[model samples]
Target: MANVYDAEKKVTVNVLNKEFDLGLMIDSYGNTGFRLNNGVFVMGPMAIFSKSVLCWNVRTVIDITPESLSAFYLLEPKLDILVIGVGNRGDKLSPQTVEYLRSKKLGFEILPSSQACSTFNFLNSEQRYVAAAIIPPTNVALNLDEEFDAGYRRQRNLRLYEE
Candidate 1:
């Protein structure tokens, strides 16, 4: 994947890879985890942050609190939206959390992880600022054999072994 700089916006865009630009993006995802642009494999819950990809310590949707999403609020360039991927299903956020984000002038949406990934990629590719916080699916065995169109597993496996 290649990065192209949008001088007017001062943001690096991944004209080659759709999901990511200057920082990390969700290259592919399985029920258990997501693969990143740089070939890193992140198992369990993760945040596809605009500036970085993080393995969130929280294990379930119930573990996600407003503080768990503080990083989005602190983003330097100010992300326009934060898409929360609630595993295989969409979940509702607490009223307090929604209110807090609204007060900060931050927009958010809750969707299934798969749909969230698509939304993030589309919005980001259009050069709209966006980010995602996703939880790995609870049912890991559901689609264990599904494959990505890019054949990304080879390098990802190699990197896992190297680590």
Candidate 2:
């Protein structure tokens, strides 16, 4: 279903040849942030990636309210899970928003921005029904799967050392 590039360690699915990539990572950023996918740039604090990218003019993670996430309701049929990238670190959501997301019965994984990007890419490449809401992290350069694996290994090593 998906073409796996073992040497490059990236996966590409043959859609309409338009390339439905959910982007790789935050290519460049500033106080305001941005995500880069296939040379297309997105400027914002929050963005939802489905069949297309929905960039939101948010300032911080706290701005993500239930009302702001109404778009996901419409995408319930298209995506089975919605992964949220919580900036450099994870943040707590308002109970109202959390409840609303839960009520929708969509699987959710809240992770750091890099991890979220990695997960989104993996799912998207497999052509799975998935989407992501991400807050771009600043000053971080990631090479999708490689960076993701390295990060995971680093975290794992930390845990092992701690133990």
Candidate 3:
């Protein structure tokens, strides 16, 4: 596997022989946090936007508030959607926070960290005006290969135990 922390880490997508920089693309993630396409490995939770990445103070879904998300509200050009990654499992935000976003006319999607990462990457690739507030999962596979192998092992173990 390539060193995720290497300063040379970059993944580009080609479109008609022209490569575009996916600066906000999440290259990898683990308990510590995420490795971005720009080769910056951010620790702890983070708020990712198209132009910048900020370290978030939130540790759990319960820590999420409109106050915690003040940065998103201040973004220029506005955001089409905000993706909230609620750690290892899917969780709901506080009613107050939900109401706050709605009142601001901000659309959002709450999902597990894993799914949120993928969704954010996809939207970013499409050049959509999107942002993400992510809480790193305490236990997670660092890459797709690891995730697939882990799932396959789990299924095999389950069959063996059942038989």
lDDT values for all models:
0.67, 0.60, 0.76
Write down the worst ten-residue block by lDDT for model 2: 8-17
What TM-score fits each model?
Answer: 0.66, 0.61, 0.72
Model 2 CA lDDT for position 107: 82
User: What residue pairs are clashing in model 3?
Assistant: none
Write the number of the candidate with greater lDDT, choosing between 2 and 3: 3
Cα displacement (Å) at residue 156, model 3: 24
Model 3 TM-score is 0.72
The candidate scoring highest on TM-score is 3
Query: Tens digit of lDDT per residue, candidate 2, span 1-163?
Result: 2233334233332212234344343333322344344545566555545446667755567877777777766853556778877676646667887898888777887787667766776777676777778776543543566456655666776799899
In the range 2-47, model 1's lDDT, one tens digit per residue, is 2222223211111224343456666766655776777787887887
Instruction: Kindly provide the TM-score of model 1 when superposed on the true structure, using C-alpha atoms.
Output: 0.66
Off by over 4 Å in 2: 1-32, 138-163
> On TM-score, who's better, 1 or 3?
3
Clashing pairs in 1: none
RMSD of each: 11.3, 11.9, 9.0
lDDT of 3 at 133: 94
